[model samples]
Target: MPKLGYTAAQIRAAEAPLLAKGVPLMIRAAQALADHVTSVLPEPSASRVLVLAGAGDNGGDACWAASFLAEAGVQVNVVPVMGRLSPEPEAGARESGARILTEAKPVDAAQLVADADVIIDGMLGIGAGGTAAGGSPALRGTARDWALAVHAALTENPHPLVIAVDLPSGIDPDSGEVAEPEAVIPADLTVTFIGIKAGCLQGEGAKLAGKVWLEPIGASQHLLGVPPAVTVS
Candidate 1:
């Protein structure tokens, strides 16, 4: 077989049936993400991990992973950039002792990024294609602020590792376009779910995404009949 890439729509289609069946895909993704983060850390108990969480399912995934990391004794801090949070996972994160920083200032957010041993970029995912009114895919509001902070901090120190939960927040998942390059934190590793996105392998996205790790989350069989949007030659 060949290396293949799927569009955001196709991936969503593949996920629909599983979600209907209530397969706990988010938990599975969270487990895989937490495992990957732990694997990269040299000392889990001593490390400071920051999760830049948005209001989407991607943010939920990060918050859930934060819970797992906190349970394992990693110092976990989550900034719900969109002000609102995914309540269930956020509750779990809090219960596991992860600090939920809801109103962090831009400078403080930057400092948090600088101080972290690892940063989980969960501010956006493929579902963040556009707004409800069909606007641009650029980062906005607190999410934009935090992304800029992460970019600046990383540029200065370059010490902390970044693990993007899915695709980087600002890049277009189908066209590989970035409306606000400054608002995107190029990942050191991206733990993508289901299939590899076509955009992640193309143009600026390839650069921003870094090493792409595909976590199936039990969606493979559902996607067997769906054709890829692009195929690597």
Candidate 2:
């Protein structure tokens, strides 16, 4: 079914109450994501998955998902786009046997992207400042390099299924605009949480997010009270 879309702010506001009450939102998101990933895998034991995780809640979701994938005997490799990962995700990934690469070079990223059966794009999410109209925004430092390398690998190989966490990095969750379309990870499937984002239905987001899947993360629609902005069949 086509899912209801909401603005990032609306989603945040709806989640605030649950977060304040210490709901396991991240874990729930990860579990749902892992379940979908497992369902798609041809052979779990032989599959290799790469997660490009940033130091944010979205990245945390990917990490937790990686942990679950690891427990299922999937070889998971995580590349931290930021310098350090958040404590909870880092711990979860390590405990579940997912290898967290401390120092990821361009070659490392290319190799991982090329070898993986699935690539989880968790580098950035709804909070990112999307690209301007005239040109693409510049990504600083290692994040830039990682984006470039991954983009290149995907373009060249075009094999592994790319699954974006929440929203694809470099996408405007509210507007569906992209700062750098070339650098953005084109998700074959985007497993969004809380509510489908408005951005996923229009502009560059529609093209970048090949197919969209919504996971509510146990948040009630009554609590969200988010009216659907648009719907895609």
Candidate 3:
């Protein structure tokens, strides 16, 4: 599909048909992201993973990827934005021996990010809408908010690799617009799934999305009609 400039909803919507056919699109997106996240981890740093999970399915993907990383011996540290995120991926993460960062005192937040070798930015992606409102919006699930707190800390001294699951949080996947993207938490690589959101392909999306790639599970075509013009990626 040429550069269709599709909305986040449209891209995700097109995925519905494929998903219903028992195609593990989420698994592909998760595993594809996992592979990218693994490429940067050195043997020395294989035991440390910092997952900044959001309150959405994208966050779940991050958690799932973390599980894969953990299996490879990476110490996965999952810090959800809210306390207990809905449709949470904690269950899957736990299956891989990953721990969710519970609400803690202010000091503990700093320790988590500093200890992590890799930071998985699972805060938001293409489906992100009213979820990422202000830079520091009210988080749900629990009391302590780790997403913004982590962003603040990472901004000061960012890690070597920031692997965003779908799209970087605070970035519009459809428009590629970043609403005050944290400098401390800029991503080094991004692995988007299903289809490339408009924001991830162009505009500020292009700036935030580094070395973009697709993760389609049995979804080679978006539509079965005349094809659209393509870019020479």
- Candidate 1 C-alpha lDDT tens digits along 1-233: 56577777778889999899988999999999999999999989999999999898999999999999999999998998989788899999999999998778677966887789999999888885533225366789888988888898888889889999878888888766788789999999999999987778776888999998999988967778788877876
The best candidate by TM-score is 1
**TM-scores of the models, in the given order?**
0.95, 0.91, 0.80
- In candidate 2, which residue ranges exceed 4 Å CA deviation? 1-3, 129-139
Give per-residue CA lDDT, model 3, range 30-69, as digits (tens).
Answer: 7888888778777724558878776677787888887788
Q: Which of 1 and 3 is ahead in lDDT? A: 1
Higher-lDDT candidate of 1 and 2: 1
TM-score ranking, best first? 1, 2, 3
Off by over 4 Å in 1: 130-135
lDDT of 2 by residue, 1-233 (tens): 76567767677778888889999999999999998888889999999999888887888989999999999999999889877777988898999899998877867766787789999988877655334323232345676678878999888888999998887877778778776666788899999988887788887888888888888877856344457666666
**Native-to-model Cα distance after best TM-score fit, residue 152 in candidate 2, in Å:** 0.9
Between candidates 1 and 3, the one scoring higher on TM-score is: 1
